[model samples]
Target: MTPPFHSRISGLAARTLQRLRSAVSGRLIDPRNYQPPLPLPGGLSRAQIHDALTAVSIDGSASGELFGYASSDLDRFLYTLAMVPEGAVGKALEIGANPYFNTLLLRQFRPELELTLVNYFGPGSAQGKQTVSFPGFKGVADAVTFQYDNVNIESAALPYPDDSFDYVVFCEVLEHMTHDPLRSMLELKRVLKQGGTMILTTPNAARLENISAFLEGRNMYDPFSAYGPYGRHNREYTRHELHMLMTHCGFEVEASFTGNVHPDIPLGQADASTLNRLIGQVRHREHDLGQYLFTRWANARVASEKLPNWLYRSYPAERMAEGQ
Candidate 1:
């Protein structure tokens, strides 16, 4: 399926911003900064790494219905997931694992992993709307279990007992839980074992494409969908915003960085040294930048004191009832 008008416009907007930066400045640029994350050490070349990351391809599929890590905000996340410190994973819980591309990737890269995939939907369920054509993951892990729970993340009690998982992968699910992100984080924290790892990825509200959207009195979201705002992205975050959310929920962030540029996004030319330098710096850490921000946090051995009143004070029960 073809991508919608908004996605194409957003991609073009992102490209134009980068190109403008490149053209307005004069200096030699390092080409490496514009490339994607470095390939993993598993003997796969860059092209192979990308293909493997996107284990399921939706190339000819229409845009909105397309699934998998290839073209969505999740592309950088799979790359970041591949880079999780080797040997750090044992038992893992994946929230929102409907598509399950990461599970497939980890099966190749970390065959010993045990995964529990928890989602509101999966392969055979009526809610299993995405990736219907891919069949299911094959020859992945020795153990992979699927569980279903459609309760809202903000207030629902996770079915698992406390401290049940060594790692929790919650990628690109946050923006969808706009009304109660803090509560969702707390839920994830409660299920994770002390010192367990939590790998998170979310869109950056300050991405260059968004900045352009704001200046033009437009937002890149699709407003007409059934989920409406939440169906697309109910909310997005900046690097600081995500860090604060994690800290408030008692997870100690270990490392953070940004990447996952749209393939159509432009990298400034080598001749536009000034713009290239700016782009390099922003891409390195922060600024008008990448499509998604990635972070890994360790569930602290000792939980912090309960979050401040302000954290939940704004979350009126009425708003929570609305459920985004």
Candidate 2:
């Protein structure tokens, strides 16, 4: 028999069945089923997409599903996992989980992980040990506390020995360490195990403003340095500068990404500049770089991966470290 003639229509029908199975764990569904959210942007700019989400936050303030997560925290969470490495995750840490999404990611992605959260201050039901001025945490989930050695990343003696965690998350946080970011990173590395991962998201100095500066032959680095913006972030990173920082600290830099869910008026989309100005007046690094091309590739199939969502999530890249 000639394999029963798998025609185009039949093949498509079979593939559709396969997809539905894969998406719904191989369950048959009626055509009237509620569709999951798609990542398609309807060709929106970065800010427009976030604005839409924010609008929902406004109208549905008491809503539980997406409302529980802060816009920034969810953005960070999406960015962090969207680019995770392939294979088993050994261990992970997020020095800053904010009040919303960061810890959610810790719980969601790697709940089995031994979790330790260090922030400038502690929030939520998470416990902490006052090692440094900053608050620390020990959140619940399948995750347990390795230790709440709450030393400031910028402080001397990071309160833990070297090569500690399998992964460390530094989201929109490093540049704020004006006192000694390098020392903080060194401490982060100290805790990160050899061949560990760092999922980093920060303001990109190489944004449209700096691109214009480059076209105008002006100094771009100083304009976006880690020195002073709202007197909060001591510096920001151009991709290369960040890579150097990680490499210098003995990190392989498993992945580096930019997610500006909090961005200035995205290019050509609804200006939102009024909202943009207000955000700028308060938030320091909101407009650095809203979207980025990925640098690394992860191993397993992402559960809920979508294009805009992936763009908004963490990406792995150039994990091949120099010495290691």
TM-score of every candidate relative to the true structure: 0.68, 0.50
Q: Tens digit of lDDT per residue, candidate 2, span 193-251?
A: 66566667676665544443444465544334342442265566676666655555554
Q: Per-residue lDDT for 76 in model 1?
A: 64
User: Deviation in angstroms for 104 in model 1?
Assistant: 1.0
Residue-level lDDT tens digits of model 1 in 1-324: 111211222344555555565556542232223334443445655455444434453333543433333545344644555545665558887777755566556655666667776665212442222332233233231323334454455656777899899888888789887566776887888889998889888877766555445544665673655745446777778877887677766788776655544542333322345444554565433232566776788888544434444344564454332212
| CA-only RMSD, every prediction | 9.4, 16.0
Candidate 2: where is the Cα deviation over 4 Å? 1-69, 122-149, 209-231, 257-263, 266-324
In model 2, the worst 10-residue window by lDDT is 1-10
Clashes of each: 7, 16
